[model samples]
Structure formats: C-alpha cells, structure tokens
Target: MYSALKAGFLALPYLSLGALAALDGHCPPLGPVLPAPTQPSKHEAVPAAAAALRGIIDQVTATYNGSAVAIGVKSIHESKLLFEYAHTPANKEKRGAQKVDSDTVFRLGSLTKVFPVLALLKLKDRGVRLDDPITKYVPELRGLKKQAREDSPVWVVDWDEVTLGALASHMAGIPSDLITDIAPFGNLSAYGYPPANTSRMLGCSGFFGTAPCNKTAVAFFEHYGQRPPAQVPFSSQTVYSNIAFPILSFAVEAITKRPFAEFVTNEIWKPSKMTRSFTTKPDDALGFIPPKDIWWDANLGFEGPEGGYFSTINDLHRFFDAILLNKLLPPAQTRKWLKPVTATSSTGLLIGQPWEIFRAENVTSDGRMIEIYTKTGDLIAYHSILVLIPDYDLVATMLLAGPEVSGSAMTLMLSRIIQTLLPAVEQAGKAEARAAYGGTYVDKATNSSITLSLSDDGPGFSISRYVIRGVDVPSTDPGSTLPPATPPRLDPPMRYRLYPATANSGRQTSWRAVGTRGTAAQVDKADAQIVWPMASCLTWAMMDRVTYNMGARDHFVFDVERGKVKGVEAVGYGVFMKKEC
Candidate 1:
C-alpha cells in the first residue's frame, strides 16, 4: 500500500507540471521587470517664493476647474530650488483635486520642439551644416504642391534648397498642414474618419493609407526636385514648425540609425544626469502620459514628433543646465542655439534658434537698473518661463500645469511674481543708470531745435525742453503734436538723430532730433513754443509689461547704452513714441 501511494504522489507532481506548462503558453511571461525608479530627494526646504507661486497655482486651478497642477522654479546661479509645488484635490470624485508630486510627469506639448532642435545641433556637431539644403539630407521634398483654390491651378514649388537653418528658424515657408484650402473634416471620429490632426497623423503608423507621415515628409523632399525659392525677409507668417519637426526627426533617424527618441535620451537626458527625464513611455507609476481625456481615447495610445513626450520640472532644469553649459553641444553650437535668428515683431520680441528674446526693464530697490534675458513656453494646460541673468549667473524657470490659460495672462502673472520677489531688481538698475549719466542736454526737431536741462529735482530728477526756433506752439491742442502737411521723408541731408536724455534711461539724447526743411509759415515761432518739463521722456515704448533682472549685465542690453534696436519696437495698439527732448 505504501508503494502505491508513493507512485500516485509522483504522478500528481507530473500532472501539475503539465498544467503549469499549458498556462505558460496561454499567459506568457510578464516580460522583463524593470526595477522601480529612485525618487529625487525631498530634503530641500521650500523657498518662501514658492508660497506665492502656490497661491497663484491654487487660484488658477480653482478658476479653470482643472484636475491637478504642478510648478517648479530654480535659481540657475545657485542651482538652488526656489519653489516646487504640486496640488490635487482629496476627493477622487472631484475632477480637480488629484494630488501630484515632484515626480509626476506631464505632457510637454509643443515643448517637444526643443528636443528636435537639440537633435539637429547634435548632427551639426557631426559635419552637417544647418545651411545645407534639405535635398542634401532628405531627397523626397523635391516638387511640393499647394492647392490654390477649388478650381484654381495648383502651385508647385521646389523645396530641395530649403536649408536646415531655415527649418530650425521657421523660415521654411511650409504651411501648418498640407491641406490648407479646404475646410478640414471637422467631425473626424463621428464621420468614421481617423483623427488627422498633426499629432494624430504623425503618431499613426500608416496615415490615410496614402503614405506614412514619415514617408510623406520624405516624399515632400522627393517631389520638390530643387531648392526652395531664395530667402525673403523673415516674417512670422513665413515660419512654420509643423513640417519642420517630422523632417528633422527623419534626418536624425537617418543619420544616427537610431530612433529620434532614443537619440535624445542618449545624447541629452543621460549626459545631463536627468534621472526623471524620459523620451519614451516610462515604467514608473509616477510616469505621466498626456491626459487623454482632453482629446483622443487613452486606449488607442498616441505618440507624435510634434508634442508627444512627458517630463518633470526638475528634469527640465537639468536639461536647461546642459544646454547652458554647452555639455551636449559644443560652445559654438550652443551659442548658435541661443542666438536670435529671426525677429518676431508681433510680440516685439526676437526669436532665437531655441530661445525667444525680449527686453525687460526694472527699477531697483535702491533705484538701480535691471535688464535680463527672458524665454517663455505655453502648452496645453501648462505655462513656463525661463529668465537668465547671465551676468549674475542667475536663471529662473516657472512651470504651471492645470487648465488652459491665455499666453498674455501667463506672462502677466510671471511679471507680477518677479516684481513681488525682486523689487530690488529694478532699483539697482536705476541707481546704475544715475551713475552712468546726470546732465543737461539739447535736441533738434524737424522744424526747430530744442534745448533741454536736466537737474536733480529734490524728490527725484526733472527735465525741461524748449523750442529754440520756429513758431510758438500751443501746449494743450490735441492736433498741435501732429507733423506738418507733408511728412519729412528720410533721405540724404534730411536725417533723424536721437540724443539721450539720460544714459540710463532708454530715452534718446536731447541734442539729436528729427530734422526737416519747412516753410517759414509752418515753422513754430521761438517765443510762442511752450516748454514741458517732465522727469523723463519716454523713448522706446513697449505696451507689454517689462521684466527686469538686476544681476545680469546683458539682461536689458537693448535698453542699455549700446544695445541694438533694428527699428522702433512697440507692443499693442496706440502704444508708440516720438523723438521728444
């Protein structure tokens, strides 16, 4: 009986092993298990500035009815954490209350363009010049066509000669989408049509069955047999990034023989030691995928070259450090990335290769001058700002994610925050200006020469200007400021000169002025002219709020003694300036 029982036990073991084998074939292994990622240390104390930022984030979240929001700010000079806050609601039932932490990732949206620029710079380091024609890399963009109208002839253009520089600077002249004339199929999903938006099209494996988006990009190269037309003046309307991203991605893949995402991870994230940064889907639970609730279904899965990546604020700071330090690309290349390539007058800002350039003016606590380099980012449900005071080695980044907000509102909020935290920033700048210049001066206008006196007014300073020639001018008439019947044309012998009222103030000098020959009747009588005394006359006027940083010498270089002004830069309607003494 004992021998029989042992035999049964042995058979039972075999039977169980057989069943396990069957289950293995049906279920398969769970694949390689990646260990949980280490979280960043949280020992650092939150800065007081973070409190103010948290309040803003709180307000914005409540106002927008957003689910969750995260913010991160760091001082680049000290590499110190200024502020980091993530908030979500306690009740899962409430859409806006889900809590978030530093590790929580969020879709960078259009911020994905930064990676492509880095990738291109990487290739440039490998003997590829940005000025090289598109044909040099992708031969498919030969003969590109544009539909003129419903029944109109199609306009074809050669895109081969378009250079990488043009693409990077957004001067490539490509439209936002291929189909521009006809209204896009609005109800794509309802009409049984695939989501053909740029994001969806780029993410799909086979787009519209006509060609893979990547192939379509390549085909664009093949069809446009020659170079694009010669360069024209840089205009915002002339630059488009939708066509640039895929083309650049294709180039990186072609040259490196690696996926664009992988190339970025190895070249950018790894070297920067950005532990929390990722290009592909991350394994950690904290890993954030774009909120699919906003648009596409989450089950479908979506990824694209334009805006399909996730990252943390901390990781982004690390990335910025790499770019600033010239660790990923050489110094020259890094300089190229930060250098302003195109001028965006619409914003009264300059567009650099990767940075948007602007002038910030600030009064210091001690009444000094403060100028700084400022860059900002706007994405779906997120807003970011990066200001670098190179002289002070100071850099600040502000990131907010919740509900959509207008770009202007975000910029205004950032300006307010800077104002509250760094009141001394502008004061120091003003003091610097005082030391630079404090003296009386003279200036000339088209019809008359004006003498101005600058004296230390007890409370602050005062300036006065009087017309030395021409007819007496009324002080209060609205139409008195208008120029004569025939406007003075800018030509030889009839020149306009700007004289500085104060070295520190952006206002021009009183000694120089617009000059024109006028009939005696139109000229103002010397005694009849009224003199207006004001502390300082406005020279360069920008309607938008100005941000200033005291630490950086070049922050507001344009407003500085020798900064360049391509033309009279202005912001918003009715905001302007005339050369006044």
Candidate 2:
C-alpha cells in the first residue's frame, strides 16, 4: 500500500505556495504555530481554558434534555488531548442510564460523507480521477432519462456530464434525496393530508421498522438515475444532496471490487485508529442507543456513506489527527483535500468536497478572523459536529444523543466552547512568539538593527524600529519616479507587520512583513468609491509589493534550533543579524 501510494499521489503535481496565496483574502496565511521546546506547551494542558470551558459545559448540560452529550478537543499537530467533557441527564441517571464519556459512541449521520471522499482520494493511487464521470464507473447510469418537476419546467439531466468531483462538492445538481426521507410513509392523515398525494419511494431506506432496506447499485440507478435535474449540472448553486455520496460509494465498490463498508474499515477506520467507529450498526450495547427508538436500528443500506456511520468523540479526534498529521495521505494531498471547492450563499460559509466550511471572525486580540473547516452530522436522535482550526492545529468534536438532542443545540454548545477556548489559545501563542521571536536583532559590522514586538492591536509582530546601512528602511520609500533602481529617501514611517509564510517553513521559519501604503487609486481619488477601501485594513494587497533585486524587500528567514529562535536573515538585503535581547 505504501509503494502504491508513493508511486501514485506523491508523484502528482504539487500545489505551490502561490496556490495558497490565491486564498489570501478568504484565509490569511498565518502558518501553523509550533510548540515551544523549552517552555511548557500551553496546548499540552490549558488549565484555565479547560476550567472556563467546563463552566460553560456545566451551564449547557444543566438545561440539556438529551440523555448524553460528549465533547472532546485536541491539538492536532501536537497530538495532545486538551479537554474533554461529558454529561448525562439527571432523569436518565435516576433510571440507570449508561454513563456518557468521550468514548461513548453515537451515530455520525452526514459526517460519514467525508469518509467517502477520503476513500476516493486514496483510490487515486489506482488512477482514479476526481473529474471522472459517474457513468464511467457505474455504466447502468449511462442512459438516464429526464423527468418533469412540479416546481420547474421539464429539463433533461445529462448524467454523463456529472463528474465525481462535482458530486463530492455539492455542485452535481442532483436531487437532495430520492425518497424525500420517510415523510411520505409517515402518518400524514393525522395532519389532514390525503393518502393519494403521499407514497413510499421504493428502494429508498428509512425508519419504516421493516427489514433492512438494502438496495444494490443497480437498484439505485434504476430508481434515481432518471429523476429530474435539481438544477443544471455543475451550476454555481449548491444543493445539499444525500444521493451524491452513495454514488461515490458505488463507484468505490466498482473500482475496488469490494464492499464499501469493508474498504472504508480497512483503508480509513483501522488506519486512523478509530476503534469504536462502524459503518454497520454494532449488535453490542456500547453505543448510546436510546431504548425503543425505531430510527436507531434503521439500516441506511446504500446510503451508509452519507449518514449511517457511528463514532465516538475520541474516534473522531483520532480521525482528524490522522488527517492533520498526514498519516492517511501525503501532506500535499491532505492540504488540497481540506480546501474549499466552491463558495456558498453566505460569505462566511464555503463548500469543500464534503466539508461545510465556516470562517470565524474576531478570534484573536487584533480582531483577525480565522477560517474553520467543519462538517456537521444529524440523524433522528443523534447530532455531531467536527471542527478543524488549521491555523492553530486544533480539532474539536461534539457528539449528542437522545430524543431532545438537536443540531442547533449542539452547535450552540460548540460555539460557546470555542469562544472561550480561542482567547486562551491566542494568549498562549502570543506568549510563545514573544519568548522566541520577539526582541531586537543587530548587525555589529554594519551597525544596523531591527526591533520586533507583539502588539494587542495586531495579529503578528510589529516592526517598532528598523535601521539598515544607517538608512531608516521603515521611514523611507523608494522613489517610483526615479529612472531606475535607486536608494530609498526619507518619508513618513509606516508600520510593517510580520506574518508567517508556511511554505518556506521547514528547517528555517519564514516570515513576511506587510507594509501598508496608499494605492495609486486611493491617493488620486478624493471620494471613496467603496465603504471599505483597499487601504483601510487589507494587508494582503500590500504584501510583496516592494521588491528589491528580485526578492521581497520585507521577507525575513529565522534560524530556529530546537524551537528557540537564534537569529534572522534578511533575504532582500542579504544580511545576517543576531538576536540582541
């Protein structure tokens, strides 16, 4: 397996740092922060943050109507479990309910969607392309017929044009679900609805309390292949579809010649060390299965890839850790996999292959926002949330089970925890930065110096003073009107901010300083054309704008030994400076 993966994906074209820079506006490159070697790592044990979080958890669980709520948080890169909390309702406790813990298992619902994507990505080793059409694998879907919809005009859905990539990203324009859930078979007569308008969709699985609704790949194509297009294939509109992952799973089985569940267990679950996770419902009593719940035993059949998997908070943390640590796939593929494929209606939300990404604001002291990659799952009585903050190398998981459990309630609990946790994370990161990188650096031969310090008003280090060759670099601007390259002259000093550029991070850490200045348009125009002009607070537009000798004038490379900052090399000026403080 290692040889196959090395030959397949490791040889694929690498996504350069330039590709990541393209997402500068959405997710600013802050680079992954490493733990300090000499100092005790705050992420290893954030006692204050944990204590505050426990308070919030207790407050939430006090009013929680569910039988159990289990939450876990970890530092993905460090592989450290930061915090864990569990709660069981008092009434359920009196009735002898099982104790809830981080290891308590609960249904994963749509979070199972992410596993199919990972499976397909690994199948890339066998020459499977994401752009390959579904018909290429499942030939039964070749001659699909179009049907008319009651809401829209008759439109033919060209199934041949739909690619696996589109399906995974929610861009395939497929129906949300073939059966519309078990609502059609529900008791609509009690709600004054006529039986003529409602009927159970054959081959569509639900909580019907019948035998397992297992349908083969052929049956799925026969029932859903001819359905009318939800929209045009590959349109900009994102339509949530449970039908997509099943198709992906079918393609997986077709390509691997193995059952989807078996392949996932061998390739993903076992490898990630998710011991309690399962595609098929376990017959044991370990799971938090509420008594007399019909939906608990309802088999999802072919739809297992979409919303049928069960996992514990501990298992989910392990899975995310595996992804972040590059245990399952190569680092490049993992980075590419975690990114968004398309934008959604909301500015803060985005759609990945199977991830429902959200961008959080005001996460730091400087009011800088961080992008959080997340996937939410929901079933009849179980709800789950998986959060990945790549910026901080953090992962948080929440699993809830019981009749009173809800998606909104779970979301609220997670939000409160994050709101409390981020401040502590930011404080710790700042402390580490100050200890390692914050101080004055001097070149004794040239009598040049640069002082860097952390500020409460910004995200990265601020250059308080910079002197190079007896010329104040921060207070001088290279005259653009000069015939060619010339020495910078005196001008008003501009504050330069330093941010981590991860692409250059390995043996030596790379950081880029962003200098803000009025753009040509902003300087010429008297009236502002936009509410927030480019010069207000957008640092991305100003980065790398001033280059000298084919290198960024503001780029700095640090020499770190065992997580201790020894010195820095000014790339553009080609000068070495030793730490003075």
Best by lDDT: 2
Off by over 4 Å in 1: 1-58, 62-65, 90-98, 143-154, 178-237, 287-292, 295-303, 362-392, 404-409, 422-581
Instruction: Please write out the lDDT profile of model 1 over residues 1-581, one tens digit for every residue.
Output: 54563344333311121111111111111110111111111212223444565676677656544444455545443364555666553322222224566666655545666777778778864688777776677765543443222221224334564677777667766544331211232455765766555522223222222223334443333322222332332445545454466677777777788887788888888998878765544553553222433311111112245555667767877877777778888876675576667766454366665456664434222222233555555444455555654433345555455434545766776665565444332233234333333222222332332222222211122223322234322221111123446433322121111222222344432221212222222222321242632111111221112222322111111122353221121111111223232
Q: Give candidate 2's whole-model lDDT.
A: 0.71
The candidate that wins on TM-score is 2
**Model 2, span 1-581: residue lDDT tens:** 43563344223321111121112211234444333222223544366878988987887678765457888877764555778898866444232237778877788889999988899999988999899998899876655452233334244556688899999999988777764444446677787766643322563465576444455443365556446778877788888888799889989999999999999999998999989898888744667765445556778777788999988998999999889879999999999998999987888899999998887665655555567888999987888889988777778999887776789988888788778886677667777778888999999898788998865455577778788877787656452222235554434445456777765465688888765433334332412443533223333443554456877677899997776788888887777789975
Per-model TM values vs. the true structure: 0.54, 0.86
Q: Least accurate stretch of 10 residues (summed lDDT) in model 2? A: 13-22
The runs of at least 3 residues in candidate 2 whose Cα sits more than 4 Å from the true structure, single-residue gaps closed, are 1-45, 91-97, 146-153, 181-200, 217-219, 479-491, 517-528, 531-542
